[model samples]
Target: MRLKSALSKVFASFVVKGIEKWKFDAVAAQERTLKKLVNEASHTVFGVDHRFVEIKNYEDFKARVPVRDYEDLKPYIERVVAGEADILWKDKPEYLAKTSGTTSGVKYIPISKQSMPEHIKAARNALLTYIHETGNASFVDGKLIFLQGSPVLAKKNGINVGRLSGIVAHLVPAYLQKNRMPSYQTNCIEDWEQKVDAIVEETINEDMRLISGIPPWVQMYFDKLTEKSGGKQIKDIFKNFQLFVYGGVNFEPYRAKIEASIGKKIAAIETYPASEGFIAYQDSQTEKGLLLLADAGMFYEFIPSEEYYNEKPTRLSLAEVELDKNYALILNTNAGLWGYSIGDTIKFISLNPYKIVVTGRIKHFISAFGEHVIGEEVEHALLSVANEEGIEITEFTVAPQVNPTFGELPYHEWFVEFVKAPVDLSAFALKVDKALQLKNIYYFDLIEGNILRSLKITILQKDAFVNYMKSEGKLGGQNKVPRLSNDRKLAEGLERYIA
Candidate 1:
């Protein structure tokens, strides 16, 4: 009864918050958020430190800090390693989030103790939204399956130095553990079979209902779960499951497989939360509400889409930030970062632009022969073809390759682990080609003359990607496969299978 009452309260709060959010359109939210941001930035910059306190409107603090990438912070991390405060204001930051990013070697972004609640609150809001959507707050009653990173700590001299995931794991309410599932340590999932076996043993017989994790790892877990359940498919094994919540990357490619595995069309929500900040989420029916932690101690910046078209690109401040623009995102999180580019690009879908679709990564692109191709264009074209032909892409990647006969071809090769293969490759290829042409005229022109060849498709075993990620040691957590390769060597490694 206590659990039921608590869940009810959570649901009520979510419904209220969600409705309140809808009342204030995306642009209005930005209007409010930006004003707060400028005010906060003034104090934060002038103080030369980050902390949770309202700043008096100091004019000098309003100067915009230059945008920076992960590379810019290497020296600060070096300072932390040498036992100093580094970029953050606090003399002692509680811990740092160690998540892998593309083109950037392992990044150790400082995470603050003050910022921790903001993350937890966002996570809870996500859960509440899920419960409100599916009417399944009973998950708190059943085993709350979290396909998450483990809480394993490195013990130095008999004291625990928290792993990034561990700090978050420690925040899980003690009141909620009686119905929780096992957390397979991300560090330990290296022994895939054993970890899979343990999770299956713990969760299979129990009435496991809800799950949250990255799509790749969640897919792997379900794949393994299906394998051990007397050859029963995933859908059959977890038939009673009410929710399959996944985040950490784009879920569009793997959506069908997850639906097929679960047997029923469960509540499928796309979450855009990270260790850095809780930015957005998608729940039942309403256009993916990017529930912003407006009051969180973070000042956000947006770089207009037009900037990307320029040779020497610059970014847009919150003042200049407008609606319906694609921008490279920068965050001045409660975690010490001044106009830090987190590398993700998003298009504000509305004028009251709280809703943003993470279009692609800024650096995930290929350029050669005056043609620039990025993940958004590829995904748009692929999905356009999928919608036209009533087909779904399982997984895909693109690369620019040179041909002796032709100048260059941006090859869009993909492996589709479909339930049923397309009956007409020729027709599907033409559809995909047309979509590509529409998105980028340069790519289309190349295809017409074989400068860029026609689209290529490869059908692999359904679990091929799951197994491949496991084999490559990138199956779980924050890791996502790069959709575009910068050159031929890496592209060639993946090209032979293109049909």
Candidate 2:
């Protein structure tokens, strides 16, 4: 075995053993984390304002700090950005993870010195867990690429500001530096398409074994590779490629088309990472869910998805979460975010090790006529039919059509970009509609009671999602198209690209 591969095995064994200690006693670990975070931040501006000193337990913490989104926390964040110290956390944050926002224009999430290590460790441990579980450390000896944002960072009030992925790029371990591709100069390109082109030029002939990114961006990279190589499969281009590490979106929707482009099925690791924290990762190949990071520097809370918008939603800790129920995930992190809502909804699949699957975004859902359809349900419904019928979906999104151009009942409108279109499009759409109705009962009732017509599918031209994302200036680097939207903003924008 190569030196790096042997070292990876030893390191992975150690990491996995450490993780196992916290896996079973997750509740205890979370209790300790909450206590530590509250105690540490008691003197900070936000902590003092929220009376964190009196927060002796989860109930007290809940009473002291209410769930807040970026907008609600913007006051403190602005203070921090203006060179304020001891505001959110004990001291000024080391970095600000800048992200585009819906109403706020731009969001700057603090990454404190204390909390930043957890982010790096979680990502490393994810790989270590994979190595430990599968005994596949050979990928360590080969080239690995993470399709990400430019590593070039801007400064805000003497603090580094960049995308989370770009921030992570600077933190990659020195040991992996030689194995990592493409070069720093190539990674510094700001334009995503141009960056991918540069990446293809740099790494096309290298022995690539592991590729990591959000699925859509990785798909674009694969497309570029094939086009450049005159339609050769990715597996043909990189014969030793074995592992795909991805996060930000569910891999299932892109699995068929992605694997087809690669020309083979390969091992994949699903991770649940966010600017707020590294939440979870697939701990086992045989497991159905990602293992929640209880020992991480964040205290987690969950409110039932149905009660999310209520005056006072029921907030439950890790101990109180039940299996298979949708909940809007809330966070209180050492980075000094108190009762922060990252907007993602998740479902616990295992209570034992606290495993979860991201269900949808709290704001990204369709409830046009009381049929509250989530991202997971729609993706599941559509992908089920597609997989069963041997059709390949490149991308899809759904929105409710409240008003029709003609004298027809309103219905759910699905805009789909397919790699392989079904032979009978109408029948295929009906089958998918049936599958969705099964997943969400309210949707079934709406269809049965004639409140809404059956869902309609609008075939989209190739690269429709790409074009739409580009128009929105969200073409790459952790930008994901919502599977279902409560409004027609995304749907109407995509209409221009309809086939």
Candidate No. with top TM-score: 2
- Candidate 1, residues 1-499, lDDT tens digits: the string is 4566366667657555765654355444444554555444344322344332433322222343455677876666556544564344354456666666656766666666667787776666666766666555666666777766656655422223454555677777665677677753533454555665678777887777778777767877787788777667665776557766777667777776677677767766667776667777764456654544445666566766547546556655444555656788878765666567777888766434356678787777766654566678878877776766667656666655455335544465555555566898777767876787788777767667676667666566655555556666776556677777666654555444433
Query: What residue pairs are clashing in model 1?
Result: 26-352, 26-353, 26-354, 27-352, 27-353, 235-261, 235-262
TM-score versus the correct structure, for each prediction = 0.84, 0.99
Error of 1 at 37 (Å): 8.0
Indicate the TM-score of model 1.
0.84
Candidate 1: segments with Cα more than 4 A from true spot = 1-7, 14-64, 132-135, 155-164, 183-189, 233-235, 309-314, 317-320, 387-392, 404-411, 415-420, 445-451, 458-464, 495-499
